[model samples]
Target: MDIRFLVTFMEVAQTRHFGKAAENLYLTQSAVSARIKQLEEYFNAALFVRNRNSLQLTAAGEKLLPFASSLADTLEQARATMNEESIQYLSIASTSNAWDMYLKHKLDEVKGHLDHVSIRAEICSHEQLSRMVHEHSIDLALTTLPFKSDDVEILELSDSMLSLYCSVGIIEEALEHFNISIDWGQKTNEALEKIYPEIKKASMRTGSLQVALNYLSTHNSAIILPAQIAKELVNAGKLHEVDSLSPLTVKCYLIYLKQSKDARLKKFIEVFKGMIENQQGR
Candidate 1:
């Protein structure tokens, strides 16, 4: 049996909701369903009795839980041991949007600050970053949403402001026709929903404003961008800010475990946090 199938089972069993399990495990619902089906087939028994309001473990599932728990614990310890061997290199990661907005500027500079700094930087999703932090697989993560946890320190930084912007030649009367939609987090989304239902009607949706920035150069389009970045483009005669509407404040957070069993990782996270605080004038 694949270990991942067991892990998926455990997450589903704990959450009792397939959609929640899929989100927590960074998997699609279909994938989680497939794994559960495979696990049930392996044991030749129904593992979960699903109903409208709840999911209960069957007799076979109850029997498998203890063994699964033991194996998963051992597997985690083994994985931790493997991670220790790579302690010479600390891993830091963030969602692609967060990295592009905040951390990308300091990537090369921070790598040289500490010894044993074989820093591994990756751009992944928010759920992936959260899992890495909980598993002690990565030293730090930056995300658009605050990951609240008693075991982690979340530093909220309000260094970004998002506002509507338009290409230099875009016609004001056609604002709805040129929408470049991007998910700018919950608060921004709510504010946008009130005024820009056209965002939903937009044919172009992207995660990065860089795509829209490139497109806006030749094509007339409207996009939301960090106020500072939009200012730079406006000064360069590429885009203009739409001042008729209010701007949204967008915040990003830096996340790291409050404590780490790995001594090297602990020290590095401390240094990185201090660097971030200093940059924000905190």
Candidate 2:
């Protein structure tokens, strides 16, 4: 069977429209139709049933779709594995601050293990990271909070705390520090809800911790951030911890699909586990 035909069939099956599939594949609509027809001829099965304005996969098509997708995915994974690139390509998803803080450090330790591994970082919510991992779009994920899942293994890397901070210059001059608040995440928001109910309305809201830091740096206000992030700025005299909520301890977790036996992944987990262990021992 032609892989190209299978590819075309899968595309059309997904979109359920020849024109849309062709657009996705960068081919002409007529060409896509021809390919689908050829595939049907080869398979001797009607893959799609078309009404006046709707498309539905026939029983044969329904059965074939999963196999075709798995084959394509296997091919892609095979390429990813056998490529002689210096760095093994690794896709990672995490919140911005976690990426900024630990990923670089971990990458430095793991670089020697691969010829070269390309690192792709996406700053997303924990749930989004889990979804991406499940879709096989990401190889691993780093998160500062725990997620509920049995399929994904959560490796605890470090115990951390969140604190409020800002540039030293800004903090020094601010009078009504009462207007300060955090960029409210479910974890931090709930923490704040319980710990400091007085600070209900956020002075600013940001999607990422980095943005909250930037906002705090530029304005005479306060932002609650991970203690590790706050630690750096505070040590540099660029920020200080607000007394209202001094610290909030949380675990930083490295999450990945529980497929325990990929060599590359195993090597990475070993390296990172050692690195973190050594860091803690010191």
Candidate 3:
């Protein structure tokens, strides 16, 4: 049977009025009636029993509602797969670690691999990251902890080693440098407290690692930063590592839709892996 017939049947069953269904489907009422009549004739059974005041689905129509709904869903999925649109859209949310180290170095790689997409990045907490993914507001994320979502696919990018760092000038008078939570959240604050139980006083509560870096640069304060970020700064003679805690490694992951089949996304993953491997070798 024609798909139009099933569509008309479903719409009529839902609205229970030929005129309303026709208006919804952008068809003439006569056209809608004809399609339903054709469907009934094809099935050799009545699909709807219409009276002067009301329309009721016949047994056949009642039985076919679920199947019709399934067909519509399948068609929607097929349309998404077969559309001729360019894959130029991607939304990403990440933790502070990603912004500090990997993103700047991988800009050229991202442009080269994902030529079609214009990247937009948001730095958010782990909980905000999870909510964005769950609500389908964000397409992907780079974070220390992978989101606990069955609908998301996570790929481990690299293990970030944490190290205390400070401005070059402050390295000499290290007593002025101290580490605090990247933000005011209890989780980050507690983590910092546990690491340094004796140092009850924090110089400041910065909003993000990026902000902390800026503060460290200007105020000559110290903070724990990812080893990759610290090493890059030290190499450029911008900052130096402080000696409070040794390097502590935490895994970073890239997360995306479980069913994402975009070629650009695939190419980006491959190029990113190569960049990470090259970094490791260096």
Q: Which one is best on lDDT?
A: 1
Worst 10 residues of 1 by lDDT: 243-252
For model 3, the stretches where C-alpha displacement exceeds 4 angstroms are: 1-87, 123-125, 168-173, 183-195, 235-238, 259-271, 277-282
Per-model C-alpha RMSD: 7.4, 9.3, 12.4
- lDDT against true structure, model 1: 0.75
Rank by lDDT, descending? Answer: 1, 3, 2
Q: How would you order the candidates by TM-score, starting with the best?
A: 2, 1, 3
**Candidate 3 lDDT over residue span 1-282, tens digit each:** 767568888999989999898777755576688788888888899998989999999999898889988988888786687555654666778877665556656666667767667778888888888766643457677877666667677887777666667677777765555645464345545665687653356666665667777666667666666677677688999877765354455567887766556675676667667877886899
TM-score against native, each model: 0.63, 0.66, 0.58
lDDT of 2 by residue, 1-282 (tens): 656667888999889898898767655566578778877898899999999898999999999899899888888887877674545767778866567667655666666655556766678876788666654557778876666866678888876666655456566744345345644457767877676565566676555666666666667665566666677777887777765354666556788767445787777777778878888889
Superposition TM-score, candidate 3 onto the true structure: 0.58
Q: lDDT by residue for model 1 over 100-135, one digit each (tens)?
A: 677777676577678555778898788888766765
lDDT to native, each model: 0.75, 0.70, 0.71
Pairs that collide in candidate 2 are 86-115, 86-116, 87-115, 87-116, 87-117, 88-116, 88-117, 168-238
- State in Å the error of residue 34, model 3: 38
Clashing pairs counted in every model: 0, 8, 0
Clashes of 2: 8
